[model samples]
Target: MSRSYRTVHIRDFHDDDLDGIVVLWEAVHNAVIRPVYSLAEVIASCQEDHAVVAVDGDQVVGAAVGRAAHAQGWVVFFGVSAADADGQIAADLLDALERRMAPLGLAKLSVLVAEHDGRVAALAGNGFGMRHTLRYLERPMPVQRRELDVLGDVGGRILPRHLWEAVAGMSAEKRLLEERLVTPLAHPELAERFGVMPPRAVMLFGPPGTGKTTFAKAVASRLGWPFVELFPSRLGDTAGGMAAALRATFERIGSLEHAVVFIDEVEEIASRRRGDPPSPTQGVTNELLKLVADFRDGSGRLLICATNFVRALDAAFLRHGRFDYVIPIGLPDAAARAAIWGRYVPASVDIDLADLVDRSDGLTPADIEYAARRASQEALARALRTDGGDAEPLGLADYVDALAATRATVSDESARDFLADIEAYGRL
Candidate 1:
């Protein structure tokens, strides 16, 4: 047999390959006197469910068998011949099996392996993580109906775990958030033991485009809680006016078991009060205050209010009892700008990191993202205009040009005012 592993090709299993697959499986688990799965079962799986085999010409080198039930998929059988037990074969077989299973609309795919199985490391390398250890148990079902699903049709979404990790930079802010917000919610038992009561309400005050909304979503992602964004502007235009809509929305939110509710640009409705005539939004503001008070009284929920102009908000809205903390998310510092630039710049591109970082001193995360996008767009446009010639590689010069053209979203005066406001009222 040729030793060139590159000759291996992955394809759907066939009936003729059953004997080879069974031989490979038996060889891998030779220590087991009794078969883990019967030959008949394997044959049936090859005929009925999704199964892929890695073949080196006519020889079956590996097999992966999976089945989808409901919204979950399981890898029931996977084995590679001892002679060809390379990571490449294992990874390819699993990848092929997953490709076949993906279109079946499964939310998750899982595999079970012995704790000591060396294949565990290979599986992890291919993006599988150990979520839990299973010990099968049987329980009686109650006769009554149970509202076990906390995620109702409340317009809330549960973000994946990777999102929090994807949010680069702002280490100081992220650390503070973990300490003040994530810790209390994720580890309530620990918090209680330390006499640290979980914070229910907090305000994220920052200049525009400073990543307040992103941080809110990241918080929800980190906590594994449902993110419910309350669009006050949209709600305000609904029937019975903004106040009534706000009240109804909160009422609906109360049903959720746990939630991280975010209200962005809150000053739209909760702005500073006016003269004797009073603004129409005053009613909405009062309704919001009442809702916050009630929400604060409850447990298993956190309210995150964000505003670009913290000074524009009503004085009562920022009081100690109303909000637990007034966190400030300012413009990205040098380290943060570098992270933002790194995220948007393609790995293949060559650029000056220090120059880009230094030049992006006053830019927000959003501004840097926009600049990066604009640079790419200009590069593509130039390439197109070059009549099919290879485009000049995107480089530091392109970013510098883009930065020159792009205006900073937050002005120097505004930044100074933000700093002044933070000094006067910032809590964290």
Candidate 2:
């Protein structure tokens, strides 16, 4: 049995669980979800937002992932093994997260479930409000960066050269870029408009290290724009400098008129326009207020901003039209974790992490990839040193050690606390 009856623990995902997570993700979503997305697209979903899993005995039976933009949230992927002992597991998981979060003081939390999916009942039972239809749009990233400047001939503007090369180098993420950013914002004209505009800003919010930075580069490369990166530490020297610096950022992007500007970990800048520390300020808040106001009505090239702390971001900044569509750069769900696992691990290894991956609850792609890389190194080290360089290929135990080496050491209590929110809210 995949589930163990004695325990169910929820926590952030660890690096080693990539493979099993992917399998469960594909299995549940593919079976129950309507409006099926491309396998690439579907896998990309794993990389967005945050999620939680359920376990009973040794088997994993349920999961729930929620992504937020503005006041709305997409319960993008969720399902329980209907055939598993608890067909109601999806609902139970989500219920747990909401109960945990409600006391923490949030005005609203939203989720989108498959309309026809019985899982909607899980949300309904939890007091979720119904909303409009939503669809995800995407396009391919250019294969090479465009060398020509913005002034180049119109036909020569296919994909700018530098941007293409950056994207091309990231094989898997490149595929995601093509699907999520490049395709939707394919044209320079569109990028410029999106970049310059304020209210309808383009936002990339996801779990940490999901290549939001690379995705930003892909946008810049695809659009042939000059890219500017902003650091949080620098933004808030003085509250007064914020508006001016932001204007400068806008002006710089506009100067290129075809450029793309990126601000990584922007939540810091907003929360720290005054940069005193973690303390929030009226001055900093006001500065952000003005910038967001101006940006919605902005004109010129594209602007891309990314933040790992989506929920921590100010609500005023998230209002519709302030940012056009807030895209999620979530953790690598199961399939993406699988792809990451396969891409990084050699097939010659005899161990399969399917069991571990299934067990892992909330690891990001980067986390999983790092574990794989470390595991491979461990195997090679054993082969070269302990086994006189004739050590057999990596085995399950080698993979297990690799996993143990990288796995997060979460006390059982802490794991429960971190996962308390998701278990209450999402039905994954």
RMSD of 2: 26.7
In terms of lDDT, the best-performing candidate is 1
Report the C-alpha lDDT of model 1 over 1-428, residue by residue, as the tens digit: 11235888888888889888888777666453334455666677788998998888899988888888899998878887766545888888888888899999999898776656666777898889876767334332211123224344456776776678877788899899999999988899999999998999999998999999999999988887778898987897889999999898898888776789999999999999986898989999999999999999899899999999888899999998989999999898787888888888999997788899998889988888889999999998999998999878788889999999889999999899998988987997
* Model 2 spans > 4 angstroms off: 1-184, 187-200, 222-224, 236-243, 272-281, 298-300, 347-361, 387-389, 408-428
Q: How far is 276's C-alpha from truth in model 2 (Å)?
A: 15
- lDDT (C-alpha) at residue 266 in model 1: 98
As a whole number from 0 to 100, the lDDT of residue 409 in candidate 1 is 94
**Candidate 2 lDDT, tens digit per residue, 235-345?**
556365665655554443443434455678877755533344545554555666676666545554455678766655676666665665566554445665555666766
Angstrom error at residue 142, model 1: 22
Error of 1 at 181 (Å): 0.7
RMSD of model 1 against the true structure = 14.7
Q: Estimate each model's TM-score.
A: 0.67, 0.47
Off by over 4 Å in 1: 1-153
